[model samples]
Target: MSHFSIIIPSIRARLFDCRSSLFATFVLLSGLFAAGCSGSHDDEVGGTPPATVLQFRLQTLRPEIREIRESITGTGTIGAAQTSNIGVVTPGIVERVFVRVGDRVKKGQPLFQTRKNDYEISEQLARAELTAAEARAEQARLDYERAIDLLGKEFISQAQLDTAANSLKAAKAEAGVAEARLAQAAQRLADTTVRAPYDGVVTGRNADEGTYKSAQTFGADSSVLQLQEIKIVVAVVRVPEIYITRLSIGTPGDIFIGGMDGLFQAEIYAINDKVDMRSRTVEVRFGLANDDYRIKPGLFVQADIHPPERTAMLLEQDAILDRSGDPYVFLLEDGIAQARPVVLREYDPRKVEILSGLGEHESILVGPDLIRLTDGDLIPSIHDADR
Candidate 1:
């Protein structure tokens, strides 16, 4: 019934007749049986066809072309729009401190008052001198007028008229000098009261009652008081020079302060042209309105600058997949799934834009079924009938 069964008996029959009969017959029969069995098995298994092709059922959508808005972020510090150091314009001893740190002040509001006893005395003396000078000048004026009339009448000599004219001129000069001195003394007396230059909040106070201040103590490094305008604040951010060209004044932005519940609206108010040599960055400032006084100076903040909207090819967020750390997606090509690597330009929570490796009318697979699909696999799209 089998080739091996028939061959073994025939080899036994010829074993004695052959030269080296046992060895030759055994070898010939072994080779013939091995060849016959392999042929039969190959036809049994290899002739069967491949299993059924796998099909993945999925929902699909076409690539969308739409406008997308993007944002560039930078870290910065919140600072006042304007700051001033309130100092004594005249050297004096502090008499009273009307305001302290955290006090809100208006323009021309008195912040502190210096001792005015000495200045008042000087002012009174100057006024008294002015009064005396004016009396002398008035007398000289009357005498000169009378002398002129007398000379016209030939009643006074020319020498007498000349002397009267000289006296009047001298007296007027002295009166003018006295008047200037009085004005100077009054201004110095007024300077004893230091007022705010603008509406702001006092951030610091270096002097108190009975403290003496001099001109040498007033400087950027030293100040009697520090005041800053907090109604409107600025966020100073350093942006790399590479992105400077894309920014412009008045470009809208948002400032997010640390630990704040909501962000403040802002706009680009200043952009420095000079690049920092060490950091290669340019300083950019965003102005934010803080009418409620929620924002304060020296707070850390982040600025999100919205440049401009751009047109790009977009797809639903579910269609994207990661393969070996690179992003790609399964596209339905001719009813079959084709895996392609795409250049992702930008993305939000809902959608992503593909810069390349896709085209118009190309559909991508969506839903949780994406992980099951493979290259060249048939994807019988469930949404196809709806189309």
Candidate 2:
């Protein structure tokens, strides 16, 4: 009842009666047998099943719009904006010291005093001379008045009147000279007490009770007290020539103090136009408010100079993957995941700015749980019901 049964008789008739055609008939019968066996095997096996498609239930989010900020980083030292090395104004021995190192003082507060003996004696002598000159002037004025009265009555000659007038003028001139000498002496006495020029902390002290200090003898290197105003500090950083164009006066930045936990806000207040040939860098000064005096001078600091902000596409950091050293993201398209390359402009721990190769509305798979995904793999979003 199979095709094999019908074909067997025909094959045998050809093999005996047609000797010339026997080879041809054998060839046909062999091919027929092979085809029949193949058909029978396939019928027993039945129909084939479809290939499997890999699937994952993953989460996704749309790219976000945000402002991308770029920053230039450098390291430098913190210092007082206002610094000075105080010196005595008058020549004398140090008599007293009111402040020591690390003492806070106000402007005009006396830091030290010099010997007052010579200056005080000079002042007293000048005052005495002024008094004597004043008395002589008064006597000369009385004599001139008496002579003028007598001249009006012709009791004194014109020569006598002229002489009295000359004496009064000379006495007045002497009194004026004495007054100037007294002023000079008084100033010298006051100069013995060297006061602070501004509110600041004393960083150094060179004079004690017996230290000899003189204003005229002091040279450029001489200093009695090193005072620095620390209420507002300056962070001086050297930025390379490349970043000079991006910075300007009033540009804001963040200063991270060495060995400190938090960052302090600072603003660019000055920029050096001359560049150092060896380092090829320009110096920039930033002012930081430190009213509490928590930030001290000579402390190391790291500065982050922020440039102007620009708009860009931002995405969650988890959505990005590094494949073969290139950044990529998997976007769900038509029930399948498609791998896409993107250019990253900036990044932080939570998010990244995509400079190019991504759209604002496109959804991307998020989280490391989907890292094993391959291109063209099926991803059925858990939120498909809402879609």
Candidate 3:
């Protein structure tokens, strides 16, 4: 009975251990089978997905070719059309000053007169000497004629006649010298008075009545008076060298003076041949009529120079992109973004003049979101409205 019980228990324990092992194995296999079924169902529902393509609805614009007249602007100062420093040619004391500061005078008008006492005395002396020389010349001529008659009558020798003729020649030379001296003295006397060179207004007065002025001190700084013709004023401005080719004499423009109302219509009167190396600009002058003496010299002015009109391609400023100091734009071709370099002639706040590198029919992308785009980007659709 003991052996039977032991063998039966051993058999039952072995069977229980086998059943436990099989149940655990079945549970693991069932879990793996469920995972496989789930994976197969997923494969049947959806396979490998397609890559997403980026699409942008971008606005585009075509380059415009039209007649454009660009206005170049610069700031400068107003100057007199003609300026002169009035000074005395001869040295003397200022006896009388006919004009004062801010006095308007005409051409050939006397502005001042120097002391005439010394010059007058010299002139009188020169005239008296001329009279004496003429009398002596007449006497020598009479003597020569008398000597010639005596020689013909055998009363005087040929050598004596020759001596008389020589004396007459010397006397005539003395008279000529006296006449030149008189003329020179008269000129010196006239130079003592200063006259107006042209029609102008006296802007300054450096000398007063009874003030002694010297001829050697006649210059801009030592001028007795400063005269300027303000009936017509000149507006001087500097223009960039790039636009110099389009400018020429008689080009029309406008100028605005500081503290003055309205624009002054003017024309290009002059342009410098050489460009300034430091500023890369050229000096230009415009002439404007100032009939009422409203425009004064040394006043600040702004100039607007209109260049000649020409046919050119212009694009909106939004379309241009700068890459490493070079300007380029994204061109739309066959629904693809293509980058193309461009050469610019001028730049403005709203538009830019294109010199080259763009075709007439080519379209460019322009909008606020242009920075997000790159070269070779696929454009799925273009905006309906064309700019």
Candidate 4:
């Protein structure tokens, strides 16, 4: 029934038929049976096995050309448009404080007053001296005029006329000195009352009633109040030097202040010309309007500067791979994976702008299988994951 069974019976018959050459016949029959058995085994197993083919199911994407708006981000602090430390110009004991901390003030508004008795006495004395000097000058002028007339009429000696003229000149000089002293005294008296230099809100109050403020001393102890103008605010931010070239005055931006409800619209009002060598960053200032005095100084803030839009080749972030510090991607070429290094213009969590080493409509491998893939590995097919 089977080749091995049929072959064994034939071999036995051959061995018996040749008894004289029994040894030789048996040896030859045994070799023939082994060959037949080997052929049967090969037939049962379906001959030599076919070569193994490796297959893989992977996701791939093509780089796309699209319009993208680039945003440069930075963090900074909010500052008042203007700040001032209100202090006295003259030394005196503070008698009354008209405004307290957190009080809103207008231009020329009274903030505090110092003891004015000493300054008032000096001003009164200067005024009295000025009046007396003016009276003396007027009398000297009359006498000089009479002397001139008498000299012309030959009623007085020329020497006496010259003396009267010298007296008039001396009196005039004294009057001028007194006038200057009176003005100085008036200014000193006015300095006893401190007024707001501009419209602002009081942020600090260092002096209270009965506190002695000195002109010689400086800083908080000498200041009566600290005022800040919050009608407008400035955001001082440090931007990386790489992005500084893309920014200029009047460039629009959005600012996010900590604890604020919404983003504030702003613009690049100032940009520092010098870059910090140590940090390689440039200082930029954005202006924002705080008409209701809601924004305060020293608050933390974030800025998003919107640059002009441009067309670029963009790809999903997953398509790019980081080998050491350099970025790479696996490109599909003729059913094989090829590793390509790419230069990135910019990148976010979702996508990346390909500055070089990639072209639009080029197929690239993506997804988790990328880790297992190697350069020159055969890819049987590509799955368009982007679709």
lDDT (Cα, 0-100) at 186 in candidate 3: 99
The digit string of per-residue lDDT tens for model 1 on 15-108 reads 6567577778889999999989998899797887655666655788888888767777888798998998878877888888889899999999
**lDDT, residue 379, candidate 2:** 63
Which has the higher TM-score value, candidate number 2 or candidate number 3?
A: 3
Return the number of clashes found in candidate 3: 0
The CA lDDT at 34 in model 4 is 99
Clashes of each: 0, 0, 0, 0
**Per-candidate TM-score against the hidden true structure:** 0.63, 0.62, 0.76, 0.69
Q: Could you give candidate 4's per-residue lDDT for residues 154-254 as a string of tens digits?
A: 99999999999999999999999999999999999999998999899999988789998889888876798999998888999988998876898988888
Model 4 is weakest, by summed lDDT over 10 consecutive residues, at: 48-57
Give the CA lDDT, 0 to 100, for residue 3 in model 2: 98
Candidate 1 positional error at 197, Å: 1.2
True-vs-predicted CA distance for residue 158, candidate 4, Å: 3.2
Q: Candidate 3: global Cα-lDDT?
A: 0.89
Give each model's whole-structure lDDT.
0.84, 0.85, 0.89, 0.88
Best-first order by TM-score: 3, 4, 1, 2
What are the clashing pairs of model 2?
none
After superposing candidate 1, which stretches have Cα over 4 Å from the reference? 1-69, 310-387
Question: 1-387, model 2: which lDDT tens digit per residue?
Answer: 999999999999877778857778899999999999998899779865544665565777888787767788888899997888777888778888899899999999999888999999999999999999999999999999999999999998999999999999999999999999999999999989989998899988766688887676654356688899999999999888867878899988898998779988878999998998999888999988888888899999889999898676888777788833789999878877899999884467788878789988777886545788999887664552114
Clashing pairs in 4: none
Output the lDDT of residue 237, model 4.
Answer: 90
